[model samples]
Target chain A: DNCRCAQCVNQDTLQRNFDTFAIPKDLSPQEISPKNDGVDVLWSDSHKSHYPWSWLSLTLRDISHKKLANQEKLWGATIASAPPEVRFDDVMSSTSPKGLADLTSKIRQYGLCFVTDSPKTPEATEKLLETIGPIRNTHYGGFYDFIPDLALADTAYTNLALPAHTDTTYFTEPAGLQAFHLLSHTPPANKPADEVLGGQSLLVDGFHAAETLRKESPGDFEILRKVKLPWHASGNQGVAIAPDMAYPVIETNGGNLHRIRWNNDDRGVVPTDIDVDAWYQAARKWDEILKSKESEFWFQLEPGRVLIFDNWRVLHGRSAFEGLRRICGAYISRDDFISRWKMTNFPREDVIASNMQLR
Target chain B: DNCRCAQCVNQDTLQRNFDTFAIPKDLSPQEISPKNDGVDVLWSDSHKSHYPWSWLSLTLRDISHKKLANQEKLWGATIASAPPEVRFDDVMSSTSPKGLADLTSKIRQYGLCFVTDSPKTPEATEKLLETIGPIRNTHYGGFYDFIPDLALADTAYTNLALPAHTDTTYFTEPAGLQAFHLLSHTPPANKPADEVLGGQSLLVDGFHAAETLRKESPGDFEILRKVKLPWHASGNQGVAIAPDMAYPVIETNGGNLHRIRWNNDDRGVVPTDIDVDAWYQAARKWDEILKSKESEFWFQLEPGRVLIFDNWRVLHGRSAFEGLRRICGAYISRDDFISRWKMTNFPREDVIASNMQLR
Candidate 1:
């Protein structure tokens, strides 16, 4: 993409702003509310205006500058200051000297964590990935872009309500954990973005989606097992996304969760199949569960805060929003994330994405 | 691809022309040399050039039709034709009925065939793929001349030569066999006009390359099995050829024949654990074999006759040249070729490339 942001000078300033959003100075995975009956997430005020369906859309666009102002106040002048690790639940909140040790245990069992008070700009996103460890660069077809392309960003393509989905289930080994730094939110200024609208960060214990599908649509699923759909994009705007690999939409293992991957837009139609109506219908049900609000947790990922989810088990998504929505993201493979967590002596199941998100 | 051709306007003329090129019309696959050859193929005298390297250098210039007229007499009009499922080692004599049958049988196993005294223009190339089977449409990708865009026929910008190196390899299942109708073999014409010159059709047998590698560099070959390399391309086009599967450059099965897939430009650098330098040396030797005249049997594929090859087994290339070189290609899967081969009977090492020449 010939977008301006690829070389945007504002990148550094933006990342610095994200560092001040909400996290503590010292970084380590710590469970925020392990004993609580439920998880709590809030959205910021500027988060709700960017959606096409939102009445607050204009408000978000109008206050874009103000949001950045708040961002600047919280994040430091440097984006690379992001901490190495974070804990989402109360799994590692122990005040004892062994807190870090307990956290390491949790991370190994689970596969994700949430860190607070991280900056939310693109610059901050890069910094977060850097501090944590080596990040796996993507192959978006042939060429890759670290930040979202302009058209993709302008539409708040990120803001579009994404269903419960993993990032690259289609890959032989999907990028493991993904981190999103929220620099600005649309509504309830300090609340999670989902709270501003009917949005939520949905994690379908892929375990559940898999078991359910296996029992309910075994026959239909078999079609995928035997089929190879040709997926290709003839050079489109100087980007060559390689053709699709023969991965199934749903993959399983003996473990608690099976990796579920489905991006409808990216799903190339199977050319040789006969009467795919039933298969689509069966697949639709699984999608419906993912999109429903009841299944997702809502929390405005504020500035200085980052949420990392397992691409395999924790399916993450966003809700409808208004304004210039922005959240910077970085990806780390599961093995690397785990290695980092353990090296820091913070292993525990609570730090994992599937540990608490599923039944 | 939307270019106007006589077929769109005149079905009779198209059919008449098609009938002349039709397989088994004049002979059976068994009767042809190395039977079971033929389907998508063509060879012509019109496309032959006094200097191929010169043709590449003549990109900006057009050739005089008078010169072509003179060459036409040397190579008789409608030199020869072939039937479906053609092979290379089979065609003994052009006039023999058994010649076409043998050629057809070869194509049955191989996927393509060849002929002589055919047209070598773009219009002729397009018609050839259209006539053989189905035309798999590719969007503009610097390859085809799209509407409002000339000089570049581009398609899905998916880059990174895929190992297993088949067209649409990224598809969960792949697309069929591809046929390249060489419309102009300007070799014997003129050389390229560039600083670097060499555009010769090169074929690398993966099976042979793999066999040698396994026997000589097993560890290096083994390293490729575990390591995943990153590859991509993007600029004014978008093609996502992401697949979850990857195979080593050399694969050995029950047959000692090693399957080779070497896309020198697309593969990422080898990992440290692997003896990349040594592996490259061995691989280079394999490449040399691919470029070897003995391994490659060549002839200017011309007019009424066509040539086809199995995209899976036969890796093809050309000695890069300067100027405007035109070849029209279309794809058909192995299954399609197989279906036709079964209609007759499998024969020899299978069908291969085209017509007669000075040799």
Candidate 2:
């Protein structure tokens, strides 16, 4: 019966103790008593449950439905004019999680945000990230701090210009939140700090671009969402990573933009079994939209400014640079980051209702 | 042009260096020269490229299409008569990877396998798992070897019977492969060695069960596939894990069964906005099929034997037991395990073709 009585469900774990399949079909409540804030029910099987009115209402409608429609604020280049920014000290020292909540909210709405005046060391940056969730360790290890040493086979390890793209298209579930801190970018020995050139961070709201394509050409949008593209990362020795299930560039959930797994660099050879020509045409248009001047948001990363962006919703890259540049970053897994966000923004009514009903 | 020429692509990394978006829209091949085994082409843009006949054919027809249809051999309780198995010494000591290859193939086709004569220690179990992929760390950490001490809040930490279910339904990408090795199942201090009761390991081929449901009631199967259900794990302190996107119980890609995310224990409250009555009816049928004797394969775990199963396709459980039972195991991430499998079973033709073409 999935009864919520103290004897049926564990208050500490919130897990049902009775067999769910054992409940008789067509089982109905023998008695229902309504209180001021809740209702008590005795099932035909003699199991009792207390359901708060608020919980009953919540069950009637999923408050989190159409998540993107309610949360995200789609934007283009205009977003650069007033980039989301929060102070590191406030985020770290606030007694209440107000500053952290603000930062996470900015990430949800704009897909990216900057925390300024943060410590410039990798150790400090790692600690800052741990405040939100655990760092997801990959083959590259957790909390990477590198200086373009060409230690790895991937282009990210070299001082090369990278086009606008989401990271980890090869991953089954790509990293959710990525944080980057440019600890230092020193010029050559003979030159001054101002002499260091290029190396500007690029951010593009992929959801905005995808939506534009949807309006511009529905056929192209359909192609992108239906054509599964194989992606791989075979650069590292003895590690040929590829998701067992290849994914379409754009993934939709209940007709809402859920994720964008686009990376030209990581794409495998396109198969000719399907309409390859149509896919190319659609992908080309999508790429053009992503690279357009109106869609691109460029910014110069600073020593004390840490940028955290949603990898699934935002495309990020960097322009080629000169001088000795040092950067540190890490990926927070999607489940871990979302868990923290849900906990932080848990509905007030649901919390009260659950506390009262469980008690 | 996405060419594989020496001057265009990096041989070691196999990553294209040219700007894909810069290719002219009207570009075409100016000339094509055919060799005995390959073809050479000169493009309108003065780009030279060579492609092997094998590569060209592989592209025309996706060799890996309908992956499930080609790989899996579904079964029910009949599988227990001749359960898939391999020896541990052969897997570890063989100079060639034939034994390991056979082991992985069994996992792919049968969704599970047993490695007999294995070392009865957690450290040895960890080493055996590493041969396939890196251990996926979670909130509980990695390589867990535990007794029913109730150290964690989850029911798994207790001696209660667990129903057949896939683990980590709350994970964004559920763990791909799970390994379990019984270090010991000693009888209570006074009981005889043969007196240990119950504790039989239960396994069910979820794909087989879902297919049976599809044949029996297409409407119910459709309901299971279309209705998204929320799942969560909030039993532990300071941790409440739930995926950003809720998934249906049955997930199919290109009309083939891809994955099964079923766990009654972890499911959240059903949203009443959907057809709750219909969903219950459909889910009840699914539960019946899973719990049916025809769908179950039960066996008692013992030392010197390790069981590894695909978490995405197989449902596992354990019967309630007495005595000091100790088990050790770990989860291998989907990406990592699949990568190893792909590399291990790489198509021979593609290999020779790539070598010749790239050279």
Best by lDDT: 2
Fraction of the true interface contacts (Cα pairs closer than 8 Å across chains) found in each model: 0.00, 0.34
Among these predictions, the greatest DockQ belongs to 2
- Measure candidate 1: CA RMSD: 25.5
Runs in model 2 with CA error above 4 Å?
A64-70, A93-95, A149-151, A186-194, A271-275, A347-359, B66-70, B93-95, B149-151, B185-197, B271-275, B348-359
Identify the leading candidate in terms of TM-score. 2
Give the TM-scores of the predictions, in the order they appear. 0.36, 0.90
- Candidate 1 chain B TM? 0.49
lDDT of 1 by residue, A22-121 (tens): 2222333333222223322222321111111111221223332122111111111131233224442222333532433333333334434566544445
lDDT of 2 by residue, B160-231 (tens): 799999999878888899999999877888778787567888999999999999999999999999988777
